[model samples]
Target: MTLSEDRVGMDPITFCDASMNLTYLGVKVSPWLGVNISEVGSHLEQVLRRVGELRLKPFQKLTLINKFLIPHFVHQLVISIPSRALLRKLDTSIRAWVKEYLHLPASTSNGILYATNRDGGLGVPVLEDLVGRVALRAGVKYLLSEDPAIRAMATHSVLQGKLEKLADSLGVKWPCSLTDLKRVRKQQKSNILRAWAAQKVQGATVDIFKGDSVGNSFLRQPSLLKPTRFKTALQFRTDTAATRASLRRAKIVKPGEDTCRKCGETQETLGHVLNKCRSMHERIIKRHDDIVKILSSESLRQDQLTTEEAMLGLTGENLKPDLIVLSQEAVFVVDVTVCYEHKGFVGMARQNKIARYTELQRQLKSRFNVTHGEVIPVVIGSRGAMPAETIKGLKKIRLASKGLLKTLSLSALRGSLELYHSFMDR
Candidate 1:
């Protein structure tokens, strides 16, 4: 309602400038007072652009109305905007005066979002559109600093880094501004961007987490299905604490077992456990030999010998068998059960590990030309713990990893070596 005498007081003023500071409401503010109102209209338009950038909607301008403008500018004004018909009549009344006094642009002839006074319209300022955006920028900055849940992810480098890339892809040019508008000024040196990012993330929320292909592969105790099933596996490293610990603990041989059971002198290493541990599986080995003897006529040719001699080439650096050893017509891939006691490694992780072991087993099968058998996952702890990979694709044990083959449970029976010898003898 740009009546010459009515312009005064606060409200998201319909327009303000030149002689236009206080409206009918009781307030007075403005340096350009008494100046023609038409002169300041263009400046108000530029101010509205700043409002749009802040993303504030028009309605919220009601709160700041009287505070910034006249004391009662909008206090008596109806909250609703004037209808189109009323606006048209007002424009008709001002069109000639505006056209002669203000050099109104012609491009906006039929537009009120911006309009040309030359086309029978009042080139009034659009104040309602500008205030909200200014409010929005302020709101964004406040939310970033006040929220906690958002900070959890902001502190994590990987997730925060990824979100920055994602924000860029969305055309949100300055990543931090979208996430945290406070970062727009580039005021600090350390990662203020990261700290403010907490606020930005808190401003957005996700309704769901954990997808379909999550931790469905790993074998964890009680089996939680998150994506980090291989949590322990991921901790493995090239050196230092985690990797060294993993190497030391993920064993087929017992943790403290000493000398090679076959020959007292060769100090037992992880390699020795797979090949020369005498106390490891005496019963299983006996059973395996007996079965092999019964399965084929080539039993006698296989060696039926003492532990020390048969295990000569089983351990140490030189004794490493290639993948071929497991596939030999009569060889058994053996792993003393120690995997169960060390960690409650999830099933999905176990499944992956078993898969890898199976691949090595397959390679050995091709090389050794041996009758294939199952990969035996045995538990060698004193607690009598036995962990089995329950997943369908990884239901068996892996007798060899990297490359040491020992006797499979079913392959160690009495006469097993005799049976292998018999087949070879033929």
Candidate 2:
């Protein structure tokens, strides 16, 4: 079925995306109204209570934790403290006693590392990743399930041109609503959202607007935004400016004040350092020679595929085909990606607008045809920079971004190039 605009959930809003597209699988997060809680504590308490009861069949199998649980513990780091008197007293008392009583080594005197955390100290699950996953689940539920409010919102978006609703209609082939517009359900709870539905197109239809019609809107550039960290509609609705603004004010980042050590020119931005500056470009060219060899050895046509460039299509319809690998017998389309978004950070996931990213990937995948048999969509994003939530949502939406294949971040491209060169030379 085609993706619908309303089906795209609040991820765009959470991540402050101007536009987004997403896919929702129909299995887990149906409109069953069973797996949602407004409060985090309440949700956790219910889960624990369910484990204790064990009588009622709770959805253990579908739980995110159960699906993507990790076995690791926190690594404890100690901040150095001054004052020889205090240090000496503690060392003579508790430190010496613990070492002697427990028969522990000198390194063990630092503290305890928990079992859950690989390095182990405080057993805290990564909260930001957890939030991002929650956001994804919410998006899935909002789209595939029978949540009337969400459905109404979707419907309104379809009725409006904000979303490409016709795609869903074409893809799914089902009439959206069973209700008659003639009847007025004044008191119905869903009516609240129905009233809020994006207004109907005024006396016009989308069929007239043809493809490539929509110039840049919020879905494209979000030019209206003043380059702020948090500009999504959800932030405005939830009044989270203070919280979001704090991130923009973070001093964790070192200023981009590095003059190129080699060229004596100012250097900044990962992209500029890696791709643009002439000195770095020369290094990259030197490195790419190795990649060229790999491509030749594989007997596959080689091409430089940049993550930023769209896949190009040689057909009637424009397509941004990233890499076209052809070997007389087979053809394959490859899409390379690098993400700069700080999704792995503690709070970045829940608030990510990954829906748009998910949709774009799907569209690119769908466009592949000239390829041999299996139309390959090669994708790679940073291990930590991309949120687990984004990955989960993308998988659910059917545009999975896999990493098992060789993927090197632009930051490490130089190293990767050298490694590739070394291996090939050997």
Candidate 3:
């Protein structure tokens, strides 16, 4: 008997007279039609539907997407290259689900959703970029395989073009050796993806890109009990919090009507409410004092600490810093200030604080008969952004930056949330 006839006799169902689609290991394979897009859509719809039925927080949903949904596409991606249009459609649907879960406005930037958590974003994975990474890694693996057939197939495949493009994008020369390509793949995998995300948010109005080095350790807190507060803080950091200014930008309010409802003197931006609003003066003082209390508890000795004492006698100016620490060798004047994170405001605040206390530093040294005195400005951003100045100041006082940053950020975010509601609910 012929080999075909023998195979047909051995498995009659497998050998058909007419060409037709077949399911092999749950993936639909056809002689003429290739991997069906409808199948992939159906799978995504089912997964997303199941996700919707679950009671999961926004962060948990993001974790599911990263850990489950993205991996679901990896096998298919490795089998065949999907079109970018399809990937974009899937991403849009997923982002819509995320927006609903987080109660975010449509005006919220997608970059903030896809950026790494350390970069002040929600750390949601981007489907398109994820696909590219998967494909590139798989392609590199096949190209470097020991099997001659796989190596030949990879050399002639479209993946070569992608590999060359990746090299060009990274400023590496094309037609690189196998060793060089493998080195690039190993070293630049995570960085290339992160760079893509960072580049996407470079032009964002709120500047959420925290860079690769400086991490927002607050996001890694282990507690999930305060998801609402976490959501509020996330919204505030991304500039999508329900402030009058954000409402105007989202077109939820009339144009040109974003003036501060409390103060009525300036536009009711987050900056205005958090730092400049007259009606919020009491709450602002409370926020400042709360930070003072934290610092006092962490860094101050009870016997040596002074709180808001008048310095007119020594400095000849009516200045009262937040806290004064009298040590045997040097006296430390620590003043705490929270300002908007944008447009060099934190640096400006730190400089102003130093200048304000320069004369007082000299006076304190003379009055206390200490060898040295320094003014430490604890400058925090209104949205919990820790500028380098804040880190330096915290280090100068021998405070643990991680715990303190988390505490300070939560305090600022809570205060901002209260201010937001106080104006909005009225």
Candidate 4:
């Protein structure tokens, strides 16, 4: 009795069949279906094993997923395009694993988890979307190969005409290269983001390309701060995590308990925790005032202000900025807010300050007889959830050093926590 006949309950195998399926480089291939679905079980199994062995922080877990799990699946798709069904299965598995690892509620939305870290999300790349992007990149790279032999072979292929027409439709100029294609795709992506932001944020003027010296400094000098601080700063700016509001939104807390545990009058929302909630008022104000005082001193040393004149609202606009620096070239209007760590709240805090002071900046410029200045919006989280943009704003105004910013922000966060717990326990 041969092995085929002896196979108990398994499907019958055709012996000596030329068209029998074969496995190559982790992919299954058959003459009929061309490429049968490859088993991705091993890929996920490895990650699951690692996840089980180690107790990791939420951000650390995100790092593990991005560094280990994502690359495993991405490499496979780059080699052979998988079916959307398979891609979705992999994505679901990864997402579930991330939720479990982060100890988040099952109700956590994909938008929150998969959003870029800079945008107040976990920054988990969606597998389904990544697979498609990888496939597109592969096709474009191959189609635009510079090798004569490769071009000849690709031109003879069925996808050639379609790809060329697609490229043409994309407005690829004659004699275009791979670089040109990538540039066009990048521009398209930027346009999409602009459109999406405009649609989602009412009255939002999408100016992502606009150069602000403060944002540029934060982005450029990342090494000036610790990794955790940098990451926290980014989260605060984006309004993603480590805040009660964010946790509640992720369903990690009961809806009723979403109100301030100490005050019990207002919702425990980010804005409430940061700007309202009388229970934490003193700490919040102290945090802002401390940062402002530090920036004010620095501005005075730089000769940007007279005795922290602009910061004290003694010199201009009836507006008290955390600090203000008046240079020969420009005058900076700086304000400070200690925001909740939640992404939504961080964004609101920054935006509110900007909106509140937009007219103030105009007023200061006209009233004080100063020109060539900018508004510096500095927002920090009580528990070290500082905004990178805040640092940039400080630097733009020559107000605060990176070390000072980190120290003051973290101290404020610690102080706020002490007050919060005391209030709650009392």
Candidate 5:
């Protein structure tokens, strides 16, 4: 039949010869190869190679991963579902690159690499989970479309089986509608993935550390401005710092040599080097004084301030607290202590400081003619963990807690790093 005769009453149609692969809307599609997986891999390789040439710090590299690299893959992810195995391989490659760039050990937990920073991880998203999230979001959007044609197409799609399975796994009810699927996909699915990542770390037999109580506040505040210092502090907080103890755990050190080289008093853990080693006493005191100095400066701006000044009387016993601020309305007896982060020591140290100054609080209240008094304990962990009590204490003094917390955390972490180096050198 002639083309015009065939198309006389309808719009003209054109056909192209079939091929093994097709590129549509910026995505490659193949019946055999399926949806741009190979293209995505090649693209990632090129981008990562370019990225590696730059002298980026660990946090900067992490920023690039979260803000740039992941988003690059996510666009493809939303359009095409990659196999979990392939996504995991991609994740492994990215993680290895991260470790090399960050100078992290191969043994570092994948959870730590992928967990949110607020949850004590580096906050890099896992590729598999990212894909799952993207898929879930897209699936829900299609399944819940107000367009009846689109909705019906989705309902009968090959993806519907997979979507139903995912919904079931995510605790969404079967035979579900638009609203139910949307809620679970958007909110609960992401949380479940995060929890799963955290659980991987928590379930590990080694490298168990809680998320920083202050939620890694230093990164948000301008505390450890130097990238190297921030990296060191991050390593310390994540329990991946190359301390003698970790070296021994990694079997890089002789068992006997794991003892503190500076003091030879105990096994050279981060906690011991930061808090308990006798040889580190001077530096440790300086660390404590640095925090006290910050507090003292803030207190000086207020009504009346005292530092380690002995209080007379009280059954002939003299008391000297780290700081005392007396105002027209209240007296605050403040003591600063940096303790090992493990085993609830920060809390104990805080309570001890409060107890030690209880009688002094009474004395200051009466002597300073203030109507109210409190014993404030500024307790920070050696690895920069700050308890709520320290925050409360800072707030009571009208101090801007974010900057102070960052300063205190950096001081503690820097001191600990210095102590680690000093011990290692000896």
Candidate 6:
């Protein structure tokens, strides 16, 4: 039959004609623009519903969103790119859900929401960013396919052309094969991701210490089942506790509670309470002594280093080493102290403590008649903060294992928390 004669006996629906919108396989196709955004929107709605239903901690919620929610949308992202407006809406809904989950104020910065866990953030994955990442990954897979059909499809794809153009624009050598493309993609992704995180975490109170085993270990530790324990660990790691300065910074309390009730003069900060507060002298001494004891026990077990001796005072001076080790190669004077977790300050504090004991080291060397002597200063922050130098020193001294460092870091944090509570009571 002719086309006009066929239409004479049939309605649009009877002929299976699509007028404005058509739904097939969960995707809504628009006839005019031939765009498939409704499917993405529906998938995003399901993700947001699951997010809203979760009754979990901030970190747990973040984990769920990244693991479950992102993947659900990414399945759709693999097929087509969601419009910018749709992406923005999805982001808004997810952020709102996160804020609701955490009971955060409306004013919380998006930067804090998306920053890395090490940068003292909840580290919620961004939907827009995840979509782009998934698209790039899909493109990489297509380029690596051995099937003739897949290879031909990739060669004709707009994404492949764009990638080549991007390489040329950046002065990067255009990738010729799947392996070279994968390598280039990996490098580009690493640089982009690092820069993205750095931008978000810039000017943040928390500091980043790359290649810091202690920090990495703490972050990688097994999850705490109890919410309280989990939150305490997270707070200590992120520096988000209800410290006087933190409270003041959040404007949760005014100038009244901002000042140290212990010293009654200086502003109470995590650094001050952990390091410089004179009122907590006894507790600080006990904390320092406790950590020293642990080190001494470890040092004594080593055959190369002799038994560690503690509280060795320099005659006619207030200078005293917390622990001293006599190794066959060198005499090691170790001084342990608690200080701020700030990366910059931790190094300075370590160096300052080492410098203070230089004269004492000389005196001890002279008295002991030791030719090779070195001072090893271990400065741990009250909140379980360990300096990179301290980590290196610990490893150098044969205490590098993950279990040992993790135990040490956790112990210091618990001890510091107990001391912090006592100060609060005072």
Q: Whose lDDT is greatest here?
A: 5
* TM per candidate: 0.17, 0.23, 0.81, 0.59, 0.83, 0.73
In candidate 4, what are the lDDT values of residues 285-330, reduced to their tens digit? Answer: 6767776677766667777763234322324545555555567756
What C-alpha RMSD separates each model from the true structure?
Answer: 28.1, 25.1, 5.1, 8.9, 5.1, 6.5
Off by over 4 Å in 5: 1-17, 20-22, 30-34, 42-46, 169-215, 219-223, 312-317
Lowest-sum lDDT 10-residue window in model 1: 203-212
The predicted structure with the larger TM-score, 3 or 6, is: 3
TM-score ranking from best to worst?
5, 3, 6, 4, 2, 1
Q: Candidate 6: where is the Cα deviation over 4 Å?
A: 1-58, 99-123, 155-206, 222-226, 232-240, 252-257, 278-283, 303-315, 366-371, 418-426
Model 5 clashing residue pairs (backbone) = none
The local lDDT score (0 to 100) that residue 266 gets in candidate 1 is 58
Which is better, 1 or 4, measured by TM-score?
Answer: 4
Q: Residue 383 lDDT in model 5? A: 69
Candidate 6 C-alpha lDDT tens digits along 49-73: 7766867565577677767766766
Candidate 1 TM-score, true structure as reference = 0.17
lDDT of each: 0.29, 0.29, 0.68, 0.58, 0.69, 0.62
Number of the top TM-score candidate: 5
Query: lDDT tens digits, residues 125-217, model 3?
Result: 666656655566666677679999998877874667766665565445544555655665445445533544454222232343365123255
Candidate 5: tens digits of C-alpha lDDT, residues 41-109: 768877777787788666677678778888877777667765677777878778888877777777766
Q: How high is the lDDT of residue 338 in model 6?
A: 69
- Per candidate, the number of residue pairs that clash is 65, 26, 0, 4, 0, 0
Ten contiguous residues with the weakest lDDT in model 3: 200-209
Cα shift from native, residue 278, model 1 (Å) = 2.8
Candidate 6 minimal-lDDT segment of 10 residues: 200-209
Write down the lDDT that model 5 would get.
0.69
Model 2: per-residue Cα lDDT over 1-426, one tens digit each: 233345345532222122332213211121343222223233344444344344422222112222332211001001111123432332233333223222333333121211111111112222222222222333334556687887665455432331233223222222323121112122221232233222121101111111111111111222322222112211221111122122223433345534443444554333333334465454555544433343233333233222334543333334443334443343434333332222243233233323213344444445543233223332222211223333343343233323311222222233323322332233
lDDT score of residue 142 within candidate 6: 74
